[model samples]
Target chain A: MQKMMQQVVCTVDVVLLTLQDSALKVALLKRGRAPFKDVQALPGGYIHPDTDADTRDAALRMLAQKTAIQPPYLEQLATFSGPARDPRGWSISVVYYALVPFDVIGQAGQADVTLASVDKLPRLSFDHRAIVNTAVQRLRGKSQYSSLPCYLAGEAFTLPQLQRIYEALMGEALNKVSFRRKMVEMDMLEAIAGEFSAAGAHRPAQLYRLKPELRDQLTLIARGL
Target chain B: MQKMMQQVVCTVDVVLLTLQDSALKVALLKRGRAPFKDVQALPGGYIHPDTDADTRDAALRMLAQKTAIQPPYLEQLATFSGPARDPRGWSISVVYYALVPFDVIGQAGQADVTLASVDKLPRLSFDHRAIVNTAVQRLRGKSQYSSLPCYLAGEAFTLPQLQRIYEALMGEALNKVSFRRKMVEMDMLEAIAGEFSAAGAHRPAQLYRLKPELRDQLTLIARGL
Candidate 1:
């Protein structure tokens, strides 16, 4: 019965992603406790079953306590579990990934949290490397036909600016006319009143922001950009 | 310390979906033990940390033991957890959704299992009703731009047969020319040697099967059907 009753360790981890200098980056912090202590890893903590309402809440709490950043968009990524994953015992981690603008992460000024280029990440704690990969894959895959890249482009941006962000995530240049057409199909953006990008002396492109209702959700298009 | 040491109940549930009579259906079983004994619910069981290699293994085990059906395509849907979801205590159920041909499920011949149309499901135990909705939504959403619906069409089928399966999941009629174009873009199917669907008066349609490598993974198209 003791073996049958053996408890599985439950925790929540966050893969906070941002776009910086045209490259995708993930937030990492030095583990303050044993079991990979002092090693850089995704922000994580044990789930407080008594106090936490759910895993999402636990994930938000861990982010606030560890990095002092509350992302505007957060979604559950996937759960990673196994007997050999953790040194302590059988364990499970309900992972969530958050998207934030580059400036927002910089504004948070998390001294302990460092941003690492996803393309050149160092050795991460536990299975965090794989977790980060999964999150990045999800972001890129969804970027094909959804407004997911908008979160990385900040609250307001010009069409050209948004296309650059999409190109960065998708790793390819998209046809401009078709890209705009797909954006129209998505219908998740609106012109920011009286706002335009200062594009030298030629033309000032109108700035746009995600519709209020779509800020927390993705607007998907049928044909990808 | 004891309160902090409290164990969260870990379980795995599967949402097995198939198409029966042109309607999307889900598999369910009657619970054999308390707390909700005799209740019809998604097949689920506790995680055997000592034996199961991972949560996916646990999910597969539950499906095999309860329904006697092994699916050709099974993917982790998401993890559902909270204190109130289960009366036992704080619990985590890693949910997986499987897609199989209707006849495969029928051939299993499990006496205790039953199929219910997704659109008209009866009251399910726990948060199962919500879980069912999520699975159905996932199926419908992916059906627009993926080979996911092919799993419900069986190993070998004609283009017309596949299109009908896609229509059933998508809940809309697709233009034939565009649908075939999208299929060509997906590039996950191949003509089966010397196989064709019989037609009473016209030419037989060539039978196709998913490419060997694409069977276990989804083939996603940029533009949807």
Candidate 2:
């Protein structure tokens, strides 16, 4: 069964996400070369053998180089590969999804980048639309059990804001009492001592962040909603 | 930015699993060439451009050729790639995991193949030991919410047998009533008409298979245990 090993091009693509205008948006950059030149695509690049320590490192580097974003929740979503995906030759892409809150988006000041809503997006180059769909599904599914939804609300947020982000992701309004109880059961959040948020024309709300032990860890909640 | 893309050697590795002596075990094949000759490793090979359709197809082909296994559950685990993972040169492995019942393993009659237990494994060549650990964790984690544990039990198995398989994979004893209740909530099982399994010195237990619609799909359970 000896055969010459086929050479395939490898790339890492990042689905950098942020919440803006109460909806999830993906960061896209313009292609500068042939094969769908000038089209908006996910932030991506070829794996650098000399610099990248691993695939995840390559994903992080690509996200930082393209969008100037270092999100708090970066995860390997899945790998997409096939013969006809690229015209040059057989190619494979290791896709990662990164989640960030609105403040990170504002800090980046990506005026030229296309920050399109996940639901309504323009035609993207390559298999990026499919990749985006898969990442969205993974994010929504994991938001129920893990400490994933908190990443979308930023570091210090009120319960009401976190609830709104969860509702936006799950596409359903949950009862306020039931939602609060569920959050309590998850035990992923902790009050920031006596810190509070300034809400104009509304009562100041207590600020909470993820438990210190769970900031970068993924733990399953016993009772998922 | 003008540098040429790195040329990385790509391959597919599979963690093929089946039950042996009431524990989860992975199939390993002996390597015939240098760079770790005669070392028992995961069933894997270089991607073939003229033959393999994609990473998954290459993994399937490797498992079939090495162990004679066509698993009921097969999925892409993760891409384990970097320089120094392989001794030959710059290499990347697209790792996948496959699950089959005991009957398939018995049918293969692999005298030279080694079925290593997931809990206690000998030193494996390359990064296969780490890959096996990752696959085992993923299987155990997903078994709580998906129709994954059923794949460990053969088709049309009794409830007790299925529960035993679940306990083996999860490494815990589950309450019988609670487990049954969770299975009922899943609604992914169907009783085989007029069929029963012969239990020694006891009444024949009813045989059930996954529902027709869920035989090939991974459906989420309402409550994960």
lDDT of 1 by residue, A1-225 (tens): 334535677889999999998899999999888899988999998888888888999999999998888888999999999988889788889999999998987788889989999999998899999999999999999998788999988878999899999999999998999889888888888999999888898599999999999888888877677
- Model 2 pairs in collision: none
Q: For each candidate, what is the lDDT?
A: 0.89, 0.84
Model 1 B-chain TM: 0.96
Each candidate: fraction of true contacts kept? Answer: 0.54, 0.53
> At residue B164, what lDDT does model 2 achieve?
89
Where does candidate 2 stray beyond 4 Å?
A1-6, B1-6
Q: What fraction of the reference structure's interface contacts does model 2 contain? A: 0.53
* Tens-digit lDDT track of model 1 for B86-203: 9988888899999989999888999888999999998788899999999999889988888899999898999989999998898889888888888988899999999998888979
**Measured with DockQ on alpha carbons, how good is candidate 2?**
0.52
